[model samples]
Target: MAYLFLFGAIVAEVIGAISTRFSEGFTRVLPTVVAVVGVVGAYFLLSRALRAGMGIGVAYAIWAALGVCAVALVGVLFLGESLTGVQAAGVALVIGGVACLELGGQH
Candidate 1:
């Protein structure tokens, strides 16, 4: 299904982002490879979702929003990063915007 492919793309994007952090400016070999591979897979899966009839506006909005949120969470939880109140609010806004996009598409 299109949604499934979108979900895969989201997950792959998250993995890519996390690996990018670990890649240390691409100085690290394994993480660098993983980052590149994950990102490539994400685009591939995203294309599949689009071919499966997901609108580009909706799919891209959801992918970008969720990927950003997931990367932020991973940074906080595993990478010892902090999320400021303002950043949290920004994340909420991003989610709200994605919800709006999905809702608007329904009409």
Candidate 2:
């Protein structure tokens, strides 16, 4: 399904982003390789989703929003990063905006 492909893309994108953090400016070999592979896979899956009839606006919005939120959470939980209250609110706003986009797309 298109949704499934989109989900895979989002997950791959998140993994790529997190691995980028571990790549240490690409000085680390394994993480850098993983980051590159994951990103490439993400694009591949995203294309599949689009080819499967997912609208680009909706798919890209969901992918970007969810990937950002997931990466932020991973950073806080596993990477010793801190999120401020304002940042948390911003995340909520992003989710809300995506929800609105999805709702608006259902003509």
Candidate 3:
């Protein structure tokens, strides 16, 4: 299903992004490779999902928004990155907008 693929893409992207913390600015070879491979695989799955019938604008919006949210949480928890209230609000807005686009596209 398109939704499944979209979720897969989100997961892969999140993994890749969080892995960057371990990659140590690309000085670590294995982690760097994992990040690159994970991200590429995510995109590949995303493209396949799009071809399966999802609209480009909707699919991309969902991917981008979800990726941002997931990556931000990982950064906050694992990487000790701080987010302001404004940044959190912005991410919530992005998620809401993505949901709206998906629902609208269904009709």
Candidate 1 yields a Cα-based lDDT of 0.97
Evaluated at residue 46, the lDDT of candidate 3 is 97
lDDT of 3 by residue, 14-100 (tens): 888877779999999998998998799889989988988888899899999999998998889877899999999999999999989
What clash pairs does model 3 have? none
TM-score rank order: 1, 2, 3
Off by over 4 Å in 1: none
Give candidate 2's error at residue 58 in angstroms.
Answer: 0.6
* Model 3 CA lDDT for position 18: 76
Clashes of each: 0, 0, 0
Query: What lDDT would candidate 3 get against the real structure?
Result: 0.89
Query: Number of clashes in model 3?
Result: 0
Best-fitting candidate, scored by lDDT = 1
Q: Tell how far residue 11 is off in model 1, in angstroms.
A: 0.6
Root-mean-square deviation per candidate: 0.6, 0.7, 1.2
lDDT against the true structure, per candidate, is 0.97, 0.96, 0.89
My TM-score estimates for the predictions, one after another, are 0.97, 0.97, 0.91
Q: Across residues 1-107, which tens digit of lDDT does each residue of candidate 2 receive?
A: 99999999999999999999889999999999999999999999999999999999999999999999999999999989999999999999999999999999897
Task: Give the C-alpha lDDT of model 2.
Answer: 0.96
